[model samples]
Target: MRSLCLLFVTAAALSGCASVRTHQGYLTDPQLVASVQPGVDNRASVERALGRPTFMGQFDNNDWYYVGRELAQVAFGNPKPKEGTMLHVRFDPAGNVATAENLGLTRVVSIHPVGDKTPTLGRNRNFFEDLFGNIGQVGSVGQGGGTADNPTGGSGSN
Candidate 1:
């Protein structure tokens, strides 16, 4: 009997869990924010209007992003958001409504960060210095005969 009680207690404890929370970034309740239009949505005013954003985006200080997510853990936890109709809204440079767009999860593509596209060049290397690395001594580059066997056009040896 004690073992059975303990088993029930253990099961109950195990069942209790912290629900996964997905912050709806950058989004305000649409109806709430929609009612706040056209009166100069400057940073402070907008914040006063929409509270705060979920996260800031890359290469943009003027834009705000709000994200609403579906909770897979529990029913009545969050709206499934109309399948793909997740709400995403963007603010304009002047802090007013730029545009509001809805993205369906079906159309949502995962983004992978590939790091900086520009190959890291020496910061101190001036333009002429960079030219030295790739362009070489004014006219030495590309002068050598082109062939896989003789990439630099030497006598088949270094």
Candidate 2:
């Protein structure tokens, strides 16, 4: 009975560490993707064959993109991309397919931030400087004959 209980506890603990895979965006079909031919397939036919694109180009409407990614995550960690595919289709002025290209995971980029705070060129300030830095600098009566109302550094007309 103790052995069986131990086995159950071990299984439960191990299950939490198992990796989970998720597929996002377009489901790729190699045969349908290969069938799309430049100069032969137009916008309408491509849409019929592959359905709507994942997204269109931000700058140009003639470019279409079909993106797919598979991410794997273990436990409570962040999901990382395991596989990625991007299909780019460009259209000519006459709406004919100008080019079709497939991009792979080589284009994926992972960035890790250096620290919690972003680096800046200016000098660093402590808690006291940040709290009391602007004490007498603002709204003083006559540091240089300038008040909050008359900030031109000269006498007021009144």
Question: Candidate 2, after superposition: displacement of residue 67 in Å?
Answer: 0.5
lDDT (Cα) of model 1: 0.56
> In model 1, which runs have C-alpha deviations exceeding 4 angstroms?
1-28, 38-40, 74-92, 102-107, 111-158
- RMSD for each model, in Å, please? 12.6, 4.8
lDDT of 2 by residue, 1-158 (tens): 99999999999999999999999999899999999999899999999999999999999989999999999999999999999999999999899999999998887687889889988876588999879876776746456745444566666565
For candidate 1, write residues 1-158 as lDDT tens digits. Answer: 99999999998876664355343334346676565455444567657766676556677865565555553444236433333234444667666665545555665676667876657743556677656654434444357654433357666544
List the candidates' TM-scores in order: 0.39, 0.74
Highest-scoring model, TM-score: 2
